[model samples]
Target: MGHDLNLNAMNYFEAVARLGGVSKAAEELGVSASAVSQQIRQLEQQFGVRLFRREKRRLILTLDGERLFQTTTQAFRMMRDVRSAIVRQRENRHFIMRVSPSFGVRWLAPRLKGFLDANPGWDLRVDGAPDFSDFETEIVDLDLRYGAGDWSGLHQEAVVHDFVLPMCSPSYLAELKEQSGDPIGQLLKARLIDSVKTHFRWDFWLARHGAMGGRMVYPLRFDRSNMAIQVAADGAGVVLESATLAINELERGDLVPLSRAFAVIKVPTYWLVCPSRHTNRRIVRLFSEWMRKEGSAHDDKTADMLRSLGCTIQEEESTILNRDIDDARQ
Candidate 1:
């Protein structure tokens, strides 16, 4: 009995240990449970050790099994990355970027055409999902994510620090005015739409104005701000959303602020994130620059618009702290 290792058996052993069962590993591998079990048996026989113990009909890895699984997982990850990188180059997958769903639909989609048109022959693939990309196994170039800019070990820069305000269609505003004289009473009586995914909520903004425990009815709820904003613009309800995402609707007079005050959201600023190595890539660098410019322009236009609308802004105490900035005061 030579101490030679079987790669096929190693694969099956890795799957069983990682998934905690032979059936699951078999299903994922598109093989039968018997075959997976056979492989595990052969691996154990070759190594002359019990790799897993059956605890209450569930597989629990032994110390040796755990150590091997760790090595196998890392090896598999590296192989996948190498394969993906080669495939991307062969298929001309130039650059892949990911952004959050609402930001893609409400903010970036309209302005993406210019970047595509400017960069000829660059195959840029964009994915809009809530899940953050794990740069270890995927060949992602850059990420435009909405967060507190606190992702560790990655280089990130703030693209925009935006505020949230109550917005509704002009027609809805007229309806509210006709129904009541007190703005707070009118808002309480009207349908309040909630964007469930945002860090800022109707309650937080309402709390700022000392309007707590009102009979607020959220007849509608959405996971994306784009959907909520659109619903509000259709005169269905009033949505408290980021001013930057609702800029187009505001400019077109499709949506108007329900209040004279905007709550500055201190966290969840849009950030451009990437591994330090990827940050120096030409496409990543150029796109990051474009995003900053667009963000700055949006801020300028938003400031001008808010000034014209005769609105003031509010900021709550810091939910996330930065060492360099002054702490937010009430």
Candidate 2:
């Protein structure tokens, strides 16, 4: 039997396998589940093997399906990259950079103007999301990430080390002052906005001041650090966030350190992470250099912003501590 496999069938089958079901794959591809199922069946007929089996009304990939799926995964990824390359040429304005959401909002977004203002001809498209693994799949040219400089199969360049601390809106601090003498003491009585269980925590910071085990009421428990920071600015609670995330707000007087009680501590830092394959790319090199200067100097800038607000930071300690607020949202 001469069976010719259709490219569309292979595409649909690949999406279904990657997404675990036809329904999900259809949603991702903006199609109908029945359409995906028909395509998968067509692929199976072409290959002369059963691709899937119904297990309690759920599609389960057969052994043949598994093998085909593996091959198709790489095939699709390569094709996507080729497509991206073509798109890149047509959009020849500047670099397309990918960044984690909080990092982009708190750090890169503000600094972007300076880069663009200096290099008027270099166009940049910044893609922000929580998932770092998508860098390769999404064809991101560069990444500004918050981690321990340990991204597998990628070139990682240091930007700045980070630390976590308490932050609240300046208005919230003012109101607390008018309401009570000690706002930190008052906050201790209220909820401390917390991220889900992760590397950075309030216990780490609180332990420095010998404070612990306070009642926590999550008015909002957001998985995204950026959202938590925004809610904190809305006077939701005193959020224990990264200096990196709060830098802009602190500088803008939108969010401020809860009180002198807050102490900055050492935590994970941001890195200019990207595929090592493109290390020599001029734009990537330029962006990485700019990131190092901007990220490392975050402390100095935050200190200046803090000092201008009459918040004296101790020089003996690393003032304006930077840290990772890349919380895993569940």
Candidate 3:
């Protein structure tokens, strides 16, 4: 056995072990499959142990491989943590935040310019993805997550409670006005735009409103709620989505509510989450305060808008865990 193992080969082996195949690890590492295979072979020879056994085209890790993987995984994570900490300390004026794509596009992206303008010296990096940020190992300082606001081992504050209802373009509604006497019935008869990714399913909304039995064919299914909303605004079909994501379009007269019946799915509230230890960071604290303020303002405005539309706003039990401070030292 070699006295010193190659760190690079160990990394390749880790990637293969994590991904469960040489080809996948190669793609992720941006190297050829043969290259990754060679590295694994080198590592096994160096360690004097078989790391993986081939089984039905998949790389199955052996007992020694599992032990080595455990060590390397922790080591890489620690390395990333150390690197992130140093970079953050050096770039104290920068803040990294993560949010789901739909919220990022429809809600936060439009408001980001104002936030940046107010804090001229601060640099913000926003990542838009469905997955939550790993605060312990990743560089993300804060996250806007859509969930129950009950994630364990994290400091969380509810940013917004979203209520979903049927919405469609004015042109589409005008077209359907002659066909059906009931508004809900018209919506059910029209082409439906469904979001496959959201917990607020069209079936659930339909069943709640007593229209589940109606035979409606969804021609288009989108993975993102924002995309579904856009399709609805284009007069393509009727969509059921969060009012928060459609606020701008609705206010702009691009879309209108189809019915007064709305469902407040309590499981998917937007939350401002961060590691409990990082809540004390100056930038995190400032960003958290700003988000809470914006959230409150949006909620108030949305409630007013709903009232004007004669749509019932179903309120969820408040999940806000923090109170606004008169003065927070940045």
Q: Write down the lDDT of every candidate, Cα atoms only.
A: 0.80, 0.71, 0.79
- State, as a TM-score between 0 and 1, how close model 1 is to the true structure: 0.65
For 1-330, candidate 1 gives per-residue lDDT tens digits of: 445878888888888887889999999889999999999999988888889999999999999888878998888778879999898788663879999998988889988888878776688789999989899988799899987677899998887766677889989988998988777877877789999877656665666566756644478999988899999999999898877888888888898888674444433478999899998798998898888888888777886786677766554333443321322112
For candidate 3, which ten residues in a row score worst on lDDT? 321-330
lDDT of 3 by residue, 1-330 (tens): 345869899889988988889888899899999999899989988888999998987778899999999999889879979999998788669888899899888888888887778777787899998998877689988999876676899899888767677889999988887788687779667888998876556765665566766454478899999889999999998887877888888889899987565533322378999888889888888777888889888888877776788787665453421111111111
Off by over 4 Å in 1: 1-93, 214-217, 261-268, 314-330
In candidate 2, which residue ranges exceed 4 Å CA deviation?
1-94, 120-123, 134-138, 161-163, 174-184, 197-199, 214-217, 266-268, 307-330
> Which of 1 and 3 is ahead in lDDT?
1
Tell me how candidate 3 scores on lDDT: 0.79
Residue 94, candidate 3: Cα error in Å is: 2.0
Candidate 3, pairs of clashing residues: none
TM-score of each: 0.65, 0.57, 0.65
lDDT of 2 at 89: 82
Which pairs clash (backbone N, Cα, C closer than 3 Å) in model 2? Answer: 94-123, 162-322, 162-323, 163-322, 163-323, 223-329
Q: Which model is ahead, 2 or 3, in terms of lDDT?
A: 3
